[model samples]
Target: MSNIKGKLIALGGGDDDVLLKLIRSEICDIHSHIEVIATATTEPVESGNAYKEAFEELGCSNVRFMHIDEANAADTTDHIERISKAGVIFFTGGDQVRLASFLNSTKLLEIMRRRFREEEIIISGTSAGAAIMSDCMIYDGYGHYSLIKGEMKTTHGCAFIKNVFIDTHFAERGRFGRLAHAVAHDPEYIGIGLSEETGIIISEGNQVEVFGPGVVTVIDASNTRFSNTREVEENEPIAVEHLIMHLLVKDYRYYLKERLFQPLTQTMPKEEAGNVALPEK
Candidate 1:
């Protein structure tokens, strides 16, 4: 439930009709303004146009396409104004680096974060967009070599959410080792691997509800008895013991503060929101 004022929605990747409908429900109404950001994509116009169409198909009359790149000014009065009026800010998938590097500390991001924290608006992203939600993110890591020490890369993210690392296309790309290695390297932060087409709605800072098809894997290493990340050579695989993990699907919820997962009871909240995989009809 988006009972809280602020909400963050992260999608692993892929778009589904049901997921789009769920996203629509986050806005105050169909008439609410939506800004589709394609800054992460190489073809921002085409990518932004597609999402603009998708939201319009959901009956959003005031959807606008926004593309910010190295060549443009992100904090212009016009961009700031549109972001202020937007009810939902949607980020399209592409390169996480381009997305974060461009907007990391912009006044535009400050406004968006403020609105998300103080208003009923939503801050949502997919794929690369999803990966940039955490304070630190996995910028690079191939699935096959992610386990090797120093293979995965991390850097400052949007910091919309803290003490966590997010990875998209988890299941499809077989990124378990990639994320596992990340958790071992930075055990202070929990690891969330979102499968393609899956997503999680995060609210009240710690509550996560699953809403799409696929799997949401949560990795916690706070209680690990041992780790060799410090001693492992650059090419050697790191290790961690006593690491905890949980898998969630639709109708399940995981609490970051509690580090626990529970099946939704029959009395689940009518309103659901947050990141990763869901089942297909």
Candidate 2:
């Protein structure tokens, strides 16, 4: 398991063509299989079909849907076997809480984690699916209300990355305050706000690079000097000091290990020179 490495793509909701193509090229070939899990979505059948069509259109011939609508379904031997053989496992958007509730601590999730650690597979998701990739997930919270104490709710996630707190449809939904609240609660964690149609690719070493047609906002509160989270009453606005933020467009790279941002021009590898094109501006 220590020698095996994989990739994780957390996407904000909407338009995943480029990201999917990249995943296919990196992890799949003509013979590789891709599993689309739509347990997080209310209409799993429809969502599954949609992804199946999309993947097929991308020339992925071995794409199948794994329907796990309940906790009991997650433990089925068939589901576990499908996951074990998949080159890619993709989760669809619905409700983060729903996904976590059934999948958490389940045998299926354990198998997925094991595959992620010991095999060369890609684990990707959008919207609520993206939120479940973190150790602490934002289950409930809205725009401005999230600025107040006790307005946000969080729960344990799939634990793909513990130090990152992910929020999808960030700017479009005005979710900065919610993500900020989570960062204020635990400054040691890095808060990632992904806008619609955007995503971040996190390598095994925690090297992250932004992609897509929108921006990715990063909020770092590790060096904060003050916060009134503890003193503020419920529903009261929080006051924090010295929180750092960075906006990243396509090609910008970030390292979670060192908490640093590297511009695309400086970090782009020579081998990938022409291959890395800037997202349409």
Candidate 3:
């Protein structure tokens, strides 16, 4: 189980002004330090600069970039210190495989996990970066092929979030089938499909609040009646029953530990006569 007390913002590809503002708010002020890890991107320098510019435009002055271009960069003491000092860390989009290959078991990852669990830092990632936030991540597979049993390729992720699988560029890329197949394979895990420009901010390890312009799709196979995942061969169409789905928009909240979905209004407490009472869902 993940004991992370920090905030994690997982975003799909495209505009992230809202996310940047949120990160800034979590930190000190315009002078608060922010680190951007562009290891997943092929053009790390370019991507890093882009984020630096974006943050700077948002009135942030102390923004740094870290890239795993070489084998030893992730393990260097300098890199570790830089990550430790940051109030907020962000990851840019590209190929998740590359990011995992470079930082999976490195000292950088170790520090990141420790800081997240021990401090009040904020971690944000987009696209491929978002996909790697869970224990089990979808590394590869398209919508059409993903529906077939054993077609989607998955790998171990950073494991910042437990018992959940994340996929980005969901609605825009038509990845419902991909997430559905993933949920069918492991009914115990919740599959989150994030559309472009949308994201989920996970707090206190379990509470997830949806944000942005697009939708956030939650696929819960916990009560699935049946699936032929093990019996079917590769390329064979999969069959599943009773998979629950929640199409959430901005302000919707989902509790991972309870597998419950509720609007933000319902989850918030009502203050009346010096007494606080939470609304029952």
Candidate 4:
């Protein structure tokens, strides 16, 4: 039910170029007049520092680093204040399970919801950082082809994009199958498959744009061809149907509101098109 829109960059895995560019753009191009507050989860201050320094190098000021894991224990109001104030919030990926457990329902979570409303809050993370953005997240697994039952586990996400399930490092790990399984079971959801070093930018109006070097795959089930999801038993080879997949490269945009994919046009004239043609009896 959160209306505030933001940008999402789900990298396939490895590569810091796009992430750094996003940080610079969010801080310099967009929120040029706001303050920058940076923080990390816990135990891996090195990664957090790397992210903070990268942004700082781009001339972002007032950078504040919080030991979120240790400090977030007592209450969330403090965490909320720190997260909400910053112009951009960067989450250095470490352990998604730990991050979810700590932030779920906390004041921090509420602040994140508010930050998106008040200002242009850019949430970028790597590895585990990217996994927590979706309602159904792919955690603790390698890729989609390894159909080992229960190898990839699904956990609670920040619910930012409620309908879609996001998996990063997609092509690198061959994760299309894992996302397909999720879609097969419930064709109502959209699967966002981001490749390594790539990112997806969701504008204020929920328009999804693909950025970076690799590809961003969009699996839409609303008009899905078919899925043998229900036919197979649990943990079995999902009988997948003809899935409508859109593989987007750099600079392409997917507008969620229009329901029309940009730059790729498939033609079906009025006679054969479903909308303009009449049903023959």
Q: Each model's RMSD to truth, in Å?
A: 6.2, 6.6, 5.3, 5.3
Ranking by lDDT: 3, 2, 1, 4
Best by TM-score: 3
| Each prediction's whole-model lDDT (CA) | 0.82, 0.82, 0.83, 0.63
Give the worst 10-residue stretch by lDDT in candidate 3. Answer: 272-281
lDDT of 4 at 49: 66
lDDT of 1 by residue, 1-281 (tens): 23347788888887655556777987748888889889999899898998899989888889998768878878989999999999888888899988999998899999987787778788888999889887899988887688788888888888777878888988888888878878877776789989887889998767788878788999987777788877889998777788788998988888775565778774434343333222111
Candidate number with the higher TM-score (1 or 3): 3
Show where candidate 4 strays beyond 4 Å: 1-3, 29-42, 70-77, 141-151, 257-259, 264-281
In model 2, the worst 10-residue window by lDDT is: 272-281
For every model shown, what is its TM-score relative to the native structure?
0.90, 0.90, 0.91, 0.81
Q: 122-227, model 3: which lDDT tens digit per residue?
A: 8889998899888889877787888887678788989777778899989888888888888788877889999888899999778898888888999988777788
Task: Indicate whether candidate 2 or candidate 3 has the larger lDDT.
Answer: 3
Badly placed stretches (over 4 Å) of model 3 are 1-3, 268-281
TM-score-best of 1 and 4? 1
Question: Residue pairs in steric clash, candidate 3?
Answer: none
RMSD of 1: 6.2
